[model samples]
Target: MFLIRTLHKWFGLVLGVQFLLWALSGAVMALLDHHKVSGEHALLPVAGLQAPAELLPLARVAQAIGQPIQKLQLKPLHDTYVYEATTPQGVKILDAVTGAPMAIDAAKARELAVGRWSGSEPPASVSYISRHTLETRDLPLPIWRVEFADKERHALLVSATTGEVMAAKNDTWRLWDIAWMLHIMDYDDRQSFNHPLIITLGTGAAWLALSGLILLFRSFRRSDVAWVLDGAEALRRRGR
Candidate 1:
């Protein structure tokens, strides 16, 4: 009984704060608007590809580039139609009209941001980042970060190589990320949910619950079992 009581006390002290954090972060995540956090509400409607009368043939482009095309797509980059392809070398963007290879510069990135942004104000700033950061660690590197002047502090991450919108982040998303990191106890990557630390803590919490239940049951009983057994035996011998 004393050992159970001691274990219960220590486990409570250890798990109390973590349990509170889990509940609080869960509540916050549930209450926030998921669409806004995911940037779905801020995405612009892109025009679909048109059936043009003439386009540069993919075979010719592949022959000129001297690389076998693995994937291909026709998409508009800033006001012009381009054939984006993935080849053995890397990603390549070519003009659909003349089959000239296209590259994304800072100015082109800004134009892409303008085309994809549905926000009211223009982008406050556009910058190129070659390395990974805390918020964009999961996304590919050498990307463009476009910031807006809206109240939510919206930012769009565009891939430098593919010209695709990688992710959208704001103040709310940042807070949610922090809460998620705390809830999962994954401080380093902030992405994993099933690491060894969390597993250990979860095991400890289950043990705490079982120990607490045993203590509660012990409280309801009178004396220990030995005293009860001795009294029952005395009554039985007296009767005999």
Candidate 2:
């Protein structure tokens, strides 16, 4: 009993701050608007665009790829139709109309970002980030980041490899990220929540709760509730 109380006190001291952080972070996250955190709203409407009535033959697409095609997708890249082919050399985007090979250069990345953006504000800046950032955390590397001058600080991440607008970011997402970092106890990349430090903290927290419950049950004695028991016996005799 003494040891359990001592351990509970120590664990409470160690995990007290973390517990508070978890509570505060959880509250903040719940308050945040999920729709604003993600950038699906920035996507341009594809209602008018329709699939091509006639697609180029697979042989033609394979020939333009110049490699053994492992997989292929016939999708619309904005208004233009293209075939995204996966090969040993990686994904190759070829024009479905002419079967010409296409490359997603820095210029093209910016162009695609603009095409996907639904805002009236022009692009403030475009930079190719080959490394990870808070906005591009856990996403595939080498994305083109496009920032807009809107009041929300709307930002877009376009895949440098595939020319696809992978993610959208804004001030709301930035604000929520801080809470997520604290909630997950992931200070570095803020990508994973299942690390050792968090696990240990979680275990310690659980132990604190369970120990408290055990101590509570053990702390009570029959004498403490004897009066209530006696009153109940008197009531039964009176009923008889």
Best prediction by lDDT:
2
What's the lDDT of the predicted structure labeled candidate 2? 0.87
Model 2, residue 123: C-alpha shift (Å): 1.1
- Relative to the true structure, how large is the alpha-carbon lDDT of every model? 0.85, 0.87
Regions of model 2 farther than 4 Å from truth: 50-59, 221-227
Candidate 1 — worst ten consecutive residues by lDDT sum? 44-53
lDDT of 2 by residue, 4-115 (tens): 9999999999899998999999998999998888767877865356767777898888778889989999877767888999889788898887888888887787788888
Q: Give the C-alpha miss distance for residue 236 in model 1, angstroms.
A: 23
The regions of model 1 sitting more than 4 angstroms off are 49-51, 222-240
Q: How many residue pairs collide in each prediction? A: 0, 0
Candidate 1, clashing residue pairs?
none
Estimate, for each residue in 1-240, the C-alpha lDDT of model 1 and write its tens digit.
899899899989989989999999998888888887788777787756564668898788777567888888888776678888888878889888888888887777778887888887888998888988876898988899999899988888888998877788888888888888898999998888889999999999999999999988878655557688889999999999
Model 1 root mean square deviation, Cα atoms = 5.0
